[model samples]
Target: MAVTLTEAAARHVARYLGRRGKGVGVRLGVKTTGCSGLAYKLEYADEAAPEDVVFEEHGVKVLVDPKSLPYLDGTQLDFVREGLNEGFKFHNPREKDRCGCGESFRV
Candidate 1:
C-alpha cells in the first residue's frame, strides 16, 4: 500500500514547483473515464486533505486519496523521455490492461 516517484520524476516535479513558487506536493488520483474505465490524474497540491495518504520519496511528496489507494497501491511513478515526447509513467502492479491509446487502465 505505497506509492513512490522515481528520482527523475522527483527532480521534474521539484523543478516545476520551484518555478511556480507554490504547492506543497503533487496529488495522484484516478478518475472514472477513458476507454479502459479509469484514468490517472495528477496535479499540484497546495495542501493535503484529511483523507489523503501521503508518501515521500526523493524529497517529493506524493498524495493519494483513500478511494484511489487500492487502485494505485505499490505504484512507482517514473518520468520518461521518448523522442520528442516526455511525461510521467505509472508502473502499477495492479494494472491488468491499458487502453490502446495508453491513457487509461483496468485492474
Candidate 2:
C-alpha cells in the first residue's frame, strides 16, 4: 500500500512549500462529504503524526494517516493542466465510482 506524486506534482508542491516557507510536506486524506459520500482532503503538514504514513517521490514527501491508507493505497497523484484550469488529480485504482460533479468517490 502506497501513495506517490508525479514529477510535475512534486515540482508544484515544492514551489508551494517554498513560497509558504513553513511546511514539511503535504497531507492527503479522505472526508465524508460530497454527493458520493467521500471527498479528498489535502493540507500542508508542518509535522508528521505518529500514525502517519509517509511516501517520498520526486523529492517531495506525501503524508497519509493510517485510517486513510486503505482508501488511498496505490494512488498516484498527478498535476495537470486543462485549458485554463490546472490542479492535482488522483489516480486511485480502488475507486469504484465517482460522483457526477467529480468531487467525491466511492469504492
Candidate 3:
C-alpha cells in the first residue's frame, strides 16, 4: 500500500520546489465528484498534516491523507510531455473505470 512517483515526476517536482523555495513535498488525494465518483487531487504541499501518510522516492516526498489512501494505494504518478502539452498523469492499478471525459475514476 503505497503511492509512488516516476523519475520524471520526481525531477519535475524537485525543480518546481527549488523554484518555489518553501514546499516540503507534494500532496495526493481524492475528491468526490464526477460521474465515476472520484477525482484525483494533487498539489504541492508546504507541510504535512499530523495524520498524513508520506512516501518518498528519488529524494521527493508524496503526502496522502488517510481517507485517500485506499483509493490511491499502488498509484504511480508521472510527468509527461506529448508534443506541446505536458502534465502529470496517474497510473492506478485499482481503477475499475473512469468516465468518458476521463475526469474521474472508481476502484
Candidate 4:
C-alpha cells in the first residue's frame, strides 16, 4: 500500500519547498471530521517523525501516519488548475463516496 503524487503535484511541491527553503516534503493524513467522517489534511513537514510512513517521488517526500494509511492507500495526489481556481486533489481507489460538498470521504 502506498500514496503517491502525480507529476504535476510533484513539480508544484518541489518548487514550493525550494521557495520555503526548509521543508523536507509534504505530509498527508486523514482526520475524523466532515460529513462523510474523514477529511484529508495536508501540511508542509520540516522533518519526518520516527513513525511516519514515507514515500518519496520525484524528490518530494509524502509522509503518512500509520493510522491514516488504511484510508489513504493507493491514493494519488494531483495539482490542478480549473479556470481561476487551482489546488491539490486526491484520487483514492478505496473511497466509496464523499460528501456532497466534497470535504470528506467514506471508505
Candidate 5:
C-alpha cells in the first residue's frame, strides 16, 4: 500500500526539481500498453490531488492515485547506472512477469 524512492532516485529527482524551480513531487501510475499490457507512467507533479496517496522517502515525495494504488503498491523506484546508460528502474513486488523488451509488466 505504499511506494518509495531509493536514495539515488531521491537525489536525482531533487536535482531536477532544483533546476526546474517548481514541483511538489513525482507522480507514479500505470497505463495499459506495450506487450505485457501495462507500463509505468511517471511525471513531475506541480500539485497534489486531494485523494493522492503520498509517500515520502529520502526527502522526496512519491505520489500515487487511488486507481493505480493496487498495481503499484510496495514498489520502489531506483536510479541506476549501467555501463553508459543510466535511468530509473522499478522494483515492483506485485509484478508477475515482465515483457521481453522490459517495457511492460503483468501481475
Candidate 6:
C-alpha cells in the first residue's frame, strides 16, 4: 500500500512549504460529509501523529492515518491548472465513483 504525488504536485507542495516555513509535510485523509459519503481532506502538517503512515516522493512527504490508509492506498496525487482553475487532483484506484460536483467519492 502506498500513496504518491506527481512531480507537479510535489513541486506545488514544496513551494508552499518553503513559503510557510514551518510544516513538516502534508497530511491526507478522508472525512464523511459529502454527497458521495467521503471527501478528501488535506492540510499542512506541522507534526505527524504517532500512527501516521508516511510516503515520501519527489522530496515531499505525504502522511496518511492508519484509519484512512485503506481508502487512500495506491492513490497518486496531481497538481493541475486549467485556465483560471488550479488544484490538487486525486487518482484513486479504489474509488468506485465520485459525486457530480467533484467534491466526494465512494469506494
Q: Residues 1-107, candidate 6, lDDT per residue (tens digit)?
A: 99999999999999999999889789999999789999999999999899999999999999999999999999999999999999999999999999999999999
Of the pair 1 and 5, which is ahead by lDDT?
1
Pairs in clash, predicted candidate 1:
none
Q: Which segments of model 1 are wrong by more than 4 Å?
A: none
For 45-107, candidate 1 gives per-residue lDDT tens digits of 999999999999999999999999999999999999999999999999999999999988999
Number of clashes recorded per candidate: 0, 0, 0, 0, 0, 0
Give the Cα-based TM-score of candidate 3 against the true structure.
Answer: 0.98
lDDT of 2 by residue, 1-107 (tens): 89999999999999999999988889999999988888999988999898899999988899999999899999999999999999999999999999999999998
Q: Give the Cα error of residue 78 in candidate 2, in Å.
A: 0.6
In angstroms, the error of model 2 at 12 is: 0.2
Q: Which residue runs of candidate 6 sit more than 4 Å off their true CA positions?
A: none
Q: Give RMSD to native, each candidate.
A: 0.7, 0.7, 0.5, 0.6, 0.7, 0.7
For each candidate, the alpha-carbon lDDT, in order, equals 0.95, 0.94, 0.97, 0.96, 0.95, 0.95
Error of 3 at 98 (Å): 0.8
**On residues 1-107, what C-alpha lDDT tens digit does candidate 4 reach at each position?**
89999999999999999999999999999999999999999999999999999999887999999999999999999999999999999999999989999999999
Clashing pairs in 5: none
Comparing 2 and 4 by lDDT, which wins? 4
Question: CA shift at 2, candidate 6, in angstroms?
Answer: 0.1
Looking at model 5, report the run of 10 residues with the lowest lDDT sum: 58-67
Q: If ranked by lDDT, best first, what sequence of candidates would result? A: 3, 4, 1, 6, 5, 2
Residue-level error in angstroms, candidate 2, position 15? 0.7
| Strongest candidate by lDDT | 3
- TM-score, cand. 2 vs. native: 0.97
Query: Candidate 5's residue-wise lDDT over 18-82, tens digit each?
Result: 99999988999999999999999999999899999999999999999999999999899999999
